[model samples]
Target: MSDKNREGKRTARERMLAERAEDEARGRRRKKLIVGGVALAVIAAAVVTGVVVQDQRSKPETPAAAPAGTIGDKNLIVPVGSDNAPSVLTVYEDPRCPACGIFEREFSPTISQLEDAGKIFTNYHIVSFIDRAVPGKGSKYAANALGCAQDAGHFRDYHDVLYRNQPDETNDAFGDKAVLINLGRQVDGLVTPSFEACVNDLEFSGWVSAVQQDFDKSNFKSTPTVLLNGQPIYPKFNNEEITPANLVKWVDAANQGKQVGTPGTHGQSPAPTSTASEPNNPSPKAG
Candidate 1:
């Protein structure tokens, strides 16, 4: 055989091998695409299933819908800890009040922990004072939004979202209608349609007005007020008791838990123990 022919044969073999390599590469790409698609489908299924499970869990088990016309009040209890909890705490807060925000962030956890353990039951009365901007207008919209959240049975989440995202108290837009709407979206079971409608309804205005009236008639002049049972959990100092840690001090002191030694705070020794059993005010409790 000629040398040229031999060389040509070798070249042909190399070309064929190259083609096979290309084919293998193409096959691998196809397999990769198939695997990626399967993985995506699995992830999608898992997400959907998770959402469904969460929905099932949040649905009212017995469904004793809050009675109609119960706009507010009637021990709207948020279980903090024990049914044997010594007292109910009623907090009147301004969504726009910085002090209130501090209290919500600082003290709420202690109360929440206690509630979860049945040691405390709490009620929240949205005071809507100092609406960040408008003298009275701020609370109106925010309070309306709270009412909407309550109607949706996701008030707890909405309430948390509000305090979690609260802006400075003197500002006007903190709890604006739009802010309320976005906050509603953050909650799992919140109904956007109903929230929008309910927030705008004038029917809930009375409830808001009533809450504010109650505060106006109270012992304290300003907000971030804590009424333990019927007695005020008045702070010894500034609204420093507004922060999460300090708020816990307030609850612990109110509950006689250890004196949490955070700076600028102290625990009050349980109301003299002999001060005739404190009576808690009647208000709507948290979820």
Candidate 2:
């Protein structure tokens, strides 16, 4: 071939080689992209599956259907201890309050002992204000369940179990009505169909509102409010650390005409005209 013709052929050959190389590069890039996309999709699917499984595992057990029985009226006063006890101990508590949970854990045993000993008549006023603060209003359902348990004559047991299993303050662990009924299982003969109906229907939710109204009328603030014989237990309000020992001493002193640490924000004196009564009212808002 002539030199010009040879040059032309060489140039064509070079062009073909370059095109082939480019096509291979493109193919490699496409294959890498396809593999990367598939890997990303698998990882995403695994993440979603893991989340679903974790959620299922974390869910509380479903409650069983129980027999029906009387669940009492809307009076939130579930009294324990002797009617003839020398002193009456009234406590206002919210199921979802962490501080209330702390008090229940640390001090309720002593109060129970005092009640059993006939030293004091214990009255529990279950409230639901924490529901206003936390999501799902679990406090309302828990308090309503308390009333149902009261009718079953196992309020204290149910109350204790609830505090023992108290969920995080911000979380609405009690939102599921089933958990409340499940808790009733802890107290034999406590979780009846009537009780279940009461809880599922928010039966004592009205009573919870009443309890809040009474709390408002009493001019007392906060959960776990303890009043001995109508006198506010100052330590609970005064921010003083309370222990079972101190609580015993306070009761002894009150029995002996002495005042425990002077009332903090709500002052104390010769027991004011007794206004302790069953709760009743409409819904309450968060403070």
Per-residue CA lDDT of candidate 2, range 112-191, in tens?
77776656666676666654434577877887777777656677778899999999776787988998888778877777
What is the per-residue lDDT of model 1 for residues 1-287, given as tens digits with 9 covering 90 to 100? 99999999999999999999999999999999999999999876543321111111111122123212222333122222223356666666666666666667766556656565544555566654453223446666776666556555555567677888876544556446766677777877675666677775534665565555555544444556676656555464243434446555656666675322212101111112232332434332221
Candidate 2 runs further than 4 Å off: 1-74, 234-241, 256-287
lDDT (C-alpha) at residue 119 in model 1? 43
Residue-pair clashes per candidate: 31, 2
CA-lDDT, candidates in order: 0.53, 0.63
TM-score for predicted model 1 compared with the true structure: 0.55
Task: Report the Cα lDDT for candidate 1.
Answer: 0.53
Q: Estimate each model's TM-score.
A: 0.55, 0.61
Error of 1 at 283 (Å): 17
User: By summed lDDT, which 10 consecutive residues of candidate 1 come out lowest?
Assistant: 262-271
Q: Point out the worst 10-residue segment of candidate 2 by lDDT.
A: 263-272
